[model samples]
Target: MNSIGVVYNNNHELHDYILKGFPSPESPARLKRILQHFVDNRVLENNNCKVLYPANVSVEDILRVHTADYFSFVQSRSLSGGGWLGNDTYLCEGSFEVLLQAVGSVLEAGKAVVTGQCDHAFALIRPPGHHACADKHSGFCIFNNAAVLARHLQHVYSCQKIAIVNIDAHASDGTQNIFYADPSVLCISVHQDPSDFYPFKGFIREMGSMPALGYTVNMEMPQEAGNPEYSIFFEEVGLKVLEQFCPDLVILECGFDSYYKEKLAKLNLTVDGYYDSVSRLRSRWHTIVLLEGGYHDDLGLLADVVLQALADNRYTKDEVNQVNLLASRQSSCRRIFDNKLNELKKLMSSYWEI
Candidate 1:
């Protein structure tokens, strides 16, 4: 089994929206349940796993991917009494501190894996960052955690190349924009089709521009697309591109919203699907899994599945009946997925051998 390190921002509760008298799916309870489940299950009792806390990241580090003015805005907004930052994002009085801790924890996870302190690391952070851009915050994300970590690795560790693979149900629009023209970082986001989805931007045609064309890949899984669809796409396109890029490290934007139980999105991924994806990536590269978006009761269970995959352990059993779930999916869903997959492959062929 591979050794795994885990880190989370303890102050995540400070960023709660309920304190601001609003009902939001992104809540402190999300992380609370996951941590509680981990403790209840003795997830860290084994020798192969270790838990770590985080220190606030410096402003200079935050400015690497965010504008100075935008950083000031978040800080100022928090101090003045947090409210919605537009685009479905909210901030409480202490959100600025929470953002710093969230980013710091993600960076710590990356450091643990790259420095050989652990074979892999998982950052169980909150206020997901995949949707946050340099100057704007959206989809409950404030700072681009993966983007900052990618830059940090390059600047501090001299890592030449890094690949970010996002599996959130929603598109990773913000991360794509940040690295759309940079070749050093290869971003692959597999999410629900954005034709009629929130933050509609991650289309197959939206490949990276100029120097980084083909480095940014987006797979728009059709509604009800499940383990079978995800597996086929990875085998045919996602994994192939990563093979060619050959990144020094892989940062997985691991989101549980793709699970069948998620109400926010219409994609179906179960424990086995999660394990298969993580295992395939873990087998090849040193990975850092950062929590992105998912608001469901099963978040804790899914987190365990990820840790099990990273550790190469078979402790968590699949509770969902895969056969039934596959049987229940509409036959038309597969047909739609196949058409989209073919189109994506043809488009990507001009860049990679896929």
Candidate 2:
């Protein structure tokens, strides 16, 4: 039986909007819903899952990816008075502390998996960090949690050749930027086509720069692309690329916004889509899942599904009928997805055998 390590804390609520005029969807309730769902479903009672409390990480850990000047600016801004870091991101007086805990939990989860203490780990933390960059926070993210954890794994555990796979609705622009020139880390972002999406990047042609060419992979899914499209891309492109890269550990930047019911994004990935995608990765590498984005009510459900998949418990039935769901989507969805997939394969053919 594979034991899955879980790290989380409700104190992340302290980072909630303090002086921001608007109520952001990335609120404390997001964590509450997932925690409550775990309790209601007795997820902790499962023999294969264990909850682990994490130690607070030092500022040195934060410096692994972020700049010292930027870190000081965030601390000083939050310490004085909470204000908007940008249009979408806000900061409260306690946000820096909350941010520390979030990073700590992620590190603990990574430590568990890297040390063979657990077969898999999930850090159910937020103010989602994929959008946060080396110099500043953006998209409700204050720190790049996955980037920090990836660097920590290499620094402390000596685990070289890490892969960060992002399945969020938005491009993992910040993460790709941080590792764009580094050859040791492989950054693959599969998100909604950024032509009309937020953080309009992750185009098919945005492979890594010289010396690290083809290390950064981005596949832009067409709007309304659902289960069938996701599965096809994974089998035809995603899995093959990862096989070539052969990472020691795969860090999933898991997000629930790709679900059919998400309010912010147009993609139509259902529960089954998420399960198959994660399952494919689990079969190949030990994975550490870090929460990124997803605002719908089913965030808890999807999180549960991800944990179950990682634990190799794949018997649960999906609540939605994927065939009927796919039939209901606009015809253009599949058409656009096919074109993008072809473009991605062609672009990557020179670097990879695909």
Best by lDDT: 1
Model 1 C-alpha lDDT per residue in residues 88-154, reported as the tens digit of each score: 8898999988999999998899888889999999999998999989999998999999999999999
Model 2 per-residue lDDT tens digits across residues 70-179? 99998998888778877489988888888888999999999899888999999999889998889978889889999999999999899889999999999999899999
User: Deviation in angstroms for 211 in model 1?
Assistant: 0.8
- Cα lDDT for residue 18, candidate 2: 44
Residue 302 lDDT, candidate 2, scale 0-100: 88
Task: Name the Cα RMSD for model 2.
Answer: 1.2
Per-model TM-score, in order, reads 0.98, 0.97
lDDT of 1 at 20: 87
Model 2 lDDT at residue 175: 94
